[model samples]
Target: MGLLTERGELEAERLTPAGERILRAASTLFYERGIRTVGVDAIADAAEVTKKTLYDRFGSKDRLIAAYLEQRNRVWHAFLDDQLAALAPQTPADVILALFAALTDWMAESRRGCGFINASVELAAPDHPAMPVIVAQKQWMRSEFMAQAALGGFADVQELADRLLLLHEGALVCFRVAAMEYAPEVAHRAAADLLAGWPRD
Candidate 1:
């Protein structure tokens, strides 16, 4: 079984028109209002579909949550890809720093912080259908950092990636949870300095 289907959930791409509407509504509601608080009823009301349609499309609220997160992962990657293309980083180091630079703009509109982090907090159960999606989202970031570090011939790629991920995630939390409005700027500067002083092969 596929990762999503291990729990018997429908994939996000096979949505019908009504399914699309349901997912669109769920994604907005889940992000705007916490996932735990929003119900299938609200999603159905927002999508203007019956609860049965929502179930038929997603199979369960848990599955819908997974699809919401999967959709978010795609959106985030696309945004980052656009940023990277626009930045046109000349070196691997530039690529790494560009990621930190992108974070400031990415969080400009939302005060809720990282959606994956928020979802992880709410879906504490390790076996939850959406847990893998949340974990994969984060792992992807770390892997990107590690890949860039390796490409740059930086020593200790694993450690470097870990440190970068820490700063990246910390800034996200501080921005929302601690109300550090300039948290992303702080992270960017920290990443730049870290890269500058980092050991080369």
Candidate 2:
């Protein structure tokens, strides 16, 4: 979704004012509530536009979902970049580990859990319009982890990244499903242990 651009906020020139409002309304409602549970009418009402306007702008609810997801991915990536800049992590290991803190902040902001994961569960169709956006978000996260592992001088960077990605996703699930506030902390500790044993060469 956001892999294409650094601009994720609604102000990006890609959408018209009304279109942006529609997407913004859908993003909040869909995340706060389930995507399927919130219909086009509700989104239109929330955005203060007619349902015809929504269909004309987005074409359909499925496409709207994709747009919303793309907007969210862009916002999330922008946030991570900001956080990374603020931390000024000296090493790849520091950057990777520091992502846990970022995740914790994200979790607090998004009490319902990962929006991509939630949409996947609700949509249930691999061929849905939003699937590409969802897949892009995951692929970007995994690839970033791999790049970080390589930067950290891990000999088995691919395998290390695979494990780290697993832990990262698992923590998101655990936090959402089990409602565990410390899931990211546990995942970070586990990642630290794994990194400790990996060959640095």
Candidate 3:
């Protein structure tokens, strides 16, 4: 299935023209400014719609934040898909490493770092409407790592996935929070070394 259809929730095609505009505006604002800082009024103004239209489209600010995250997830997955196609990794291990390699370009395109991580930090409420979307995004990465490790016949796939996820998220945090310019490159090399030394079944 296509990326839009994969998640089966809030696909782009399902959105109305106003909803589309609202989402487009919200996504950009949320990423650039932050979820907590941006308001529905600002999003409506950016989208050239009224506050009533924004509320009618998204119901509330919380749902709008969730929609923004969902849209981001789609964009991220599409980016990785394009990278994997271009790199054409020969093995599952190579595929895993290719994801790390893609991070450099991904980070370069947007120095703001992972949107999900930023949202998680800003949305402190565990019961927040967007919390599940944020958590699922990170979990999907870990799941992908584990699936690739298993495909490569790696020993202790769970443990390997956990380690890879830590390295991946750590690099994202360091890049933005600590201002490590070469963080993604460093992560790529570290992943390569980790894969090289990882035991195979």
Candidate 4:
């Protein structure tokens, strides 16, 4: 059977220590070095496994790239979930601004802007195996933001989501461009003001 399929590869019966090691190494290598830059040989050496073993387990470099992106998607969602959980019984302004706070905290220790964003830039090919993973992740994030906006009592949840998404992404770009740490705070305030001026439900 061809390795690339819509459902993705079957889960192995059991993962060996080496398999786990390979995943761990891939996690670091793929995030630190761009996926295109980190070849199978690099992954094998870092995991102390043979290239054949890597292929036997994952089928191909493309599959491994999908796996790596799936792993990262889970991590990014988990971070957003954690933030949402902290703000349960959500208030309008606080919940909205909390996202900004979360972004601020994330940027301070993130070391780089975002693994998914960085990887997407490197994988310019539209049909790359990792592209669906990126699109799915981003759609999920937008959904989460809309859900939060609803919880915060906004009549225009989608609009708020769009605005917040723009501001949030803008803060990341500004942070990268300006090499400044305060952009998130400013964005958060601006977001709060936008919400405040809106006609309330």
Best by TM-score: 3
Q: How far is candidate 4 from the true structure (C-alpha RMSD, Å)?
A: 6.4
lDDT of 1 at 60: 99
Q: How high a TM-score does candidate 3 get?
A: 0.94
1-201: candidate 4 lDDT, tens digit per residue: 111112232233356788778878998998776777898999999999999999988888887787787776666555655875765524645666776777877788766666767778888888988788877766655665677667667778888778878887778777766776788888888888887876546
- The superposed Cα distance between candidate 4 and the true structure at residue 151, in angstroms, equals 3.3
Candidate 1 per-residue lDDT over residues 35-65, each given as its tens digit? 9999999999999999999998889999999
What are the models' TM-scores?
A: 0.93, 0.92, 0.94, 0.80
For model 2, the run of ten residues with the poorest summed lDDT: 1-10
Please list the C-alpha lDDT of all candidates, in the order they appear.
Answer: 0.88, 0.84, 0.88, 0.73
Worst 10 residues of 1 by lDDT: 1-10
Off by over 4 Å in 3: 1-13
Going through the candidates in the order shown, the clash numbers are: 0, 0, 0, 0
**On TM-score, who's better, 1 or 2?**
1
Report how far off residue 185 is in candidate 2 (Å): 1.3
Give lDDT tens digits, candidate 2, residues 100-179: 66887888888898999999899888899999888888877777777788877998888888899899999999999999
Provide the global lDDT of candidate 1 against the true structure.
0.88
- How well is each residue in 1-201 modelled by candidate 3, as lDDT tens digits? 221113433455478899999999999999999987898889999999999999988889999998889888888888988988888888889888989999999999887988999999999999999998888888888888898899899999999999999999999999999999799999889999999999999
Ranking by TM-score: 3, 1, 2, 4
Better of 3 and 4 by TM-score: 3
